[model samples]
Target: MVIPPPVRPPRITEFLKPYVLKMHFTNKYVHAQVIHSPTPTVTASVSSQEKALRSSMGITRDVAAVAKIGKILGERLLIKDIPAVTVFLKRDQKYHGKIKAVIDSMIKAGVKLL
Candidate 1:
């Protein structure tokens, strides 16, 4: 008789990429953060909901605002010695418009997309 080898749980968030970039869009604001999947800890984050950013960027739901958020997030990650990240978009989210903008800006800022 033989038994199957242990398999990793399906609920594990990160399998290939250790660092992950998560984003959320609200009625009036956009939020983003980088998390260390294993530890489930946030490494860096930025949002249009932040007081300082809200004061400067009036409209937070626009693609430009999202791009800025991605750039800032990439910079923050690099500052913390994270060189790459994998994006975790929502189910209905597609790699278009604002999503594309964020990924592009992050790549431009020197963060490799995995």
Candidate 2:
């Protein structure tokens, strides 16, 4: 019997080394950190999944949701003394429409995806 090779998780460091990575999920959450580092050391992050925001804006397929996540992420990053990051859109999704809108918004708000 033949067996398949073990699947490897997407490595963020492989793409953006020596810099902070701001990875946003399709869900309401955004996770930011330096690659190959521990979770507690996350540079910044945010999510509409938070209690207050979740009640006002339940999960929905609207550009506003993505934008809000971006804004929240930007604010958190600012507070953490991180002024910029390399936006790593996880899972190989194309950058268009809602994602593009959110990314643009982040740039405007000072995320600086590069």
Candidate 3:
């Protein structure tokens, strides 16, 4: 007998659309910011394109790149005395993969996800 695939419940974001802070790191660029949240609240962020970690890591792909961004974000949080924060993994329709690696880095750095 063949087994059927399990059905997953709709994502929380699909309904709640929680506030998201995100950053994108690529071979040549890094963009970071907060999204869908209230105004006047600056979600301190950093990225490779900001010249901080853009050239810090030689390898830009997979876990290497993800680790670099995680370090940057962690540093920023540390400087602000923020012990932990909720993170929304944003990859524009892409799930798991490198995104998972990035989230892992955040967790290791002491981030609390909602």
Candidate 4:
């Protein structure tokens, strides 16, 4: 028999009751936001599609860009007085590569992973 690894604290708690991080990826860009789940409102967001990032980054869809996006999100949340957030990945997505980079960078930027 095989066992699935335990889910992490942040990943287990969806935004239905607390702040959550959401991600959107396209062939040309990466977007992310923090949502206040109960009311379904966005608290903070960042995207590689912004003019400032588009001119600075050669590839918006890359892992490095996603990491930068995560860092930005963390900073934004901190400014909003939100110190922690759980990641809310869609069913089609798994935690790896770009997703992992985002989470790691957010932690490095000082956002407590739920």
Which candidate has the top score in TM-score?
A: 1
- Model 2 C-alpha lDDT versus the unseen true structure: 0.62
For candidate 4, give the lDDT of residue 85.
Answer: 92
> Candidate 4: which stretches are off by over 4 Å?
1-16
Q: Please give each candidate's TM-score.
A: 0.84, 0.62, 0.60, 0.82
Off by over 4 Å in 2: 1-40
Clashing pairs in 3: none
Question: How do the residues 48-93 of candidate 1 rate in per-residue lDDT, one tens digit apiece?
Answer: 9888788778688999999999888889988999999989988999
**Model 2 CA RMSD to the hidden true structure, in angstroms:** 9.9
Query: lDDT per residue, candidate 2, 40-110, as tens digits?
Result: 35655555556777777756446777777677767766676666665556677688966776677777788
Question: Which ranges of candidate 1 are over 4 A from the true structure?
Answer: 1-15
CA lDDT for candidate 3: 0.61
lDDT of 3 by residue, 5-109 (tens): 999997655665344557575665555554445343656665655555556667555577766677667666667666655566644736476666656776687
Order of quality (lDDT): 4, 1, 2, 3
lDDT of each: 0.88, 0.62, 0.61, 0.88
Q: What C-alpha lDDT, on a 0 to 100 scale, does residue 12 get in candidate 1?
A: 53
The digit string of per-residue lDDT tens for model 4 on 21-64 reads 88998898889999988778899999998888788888889899
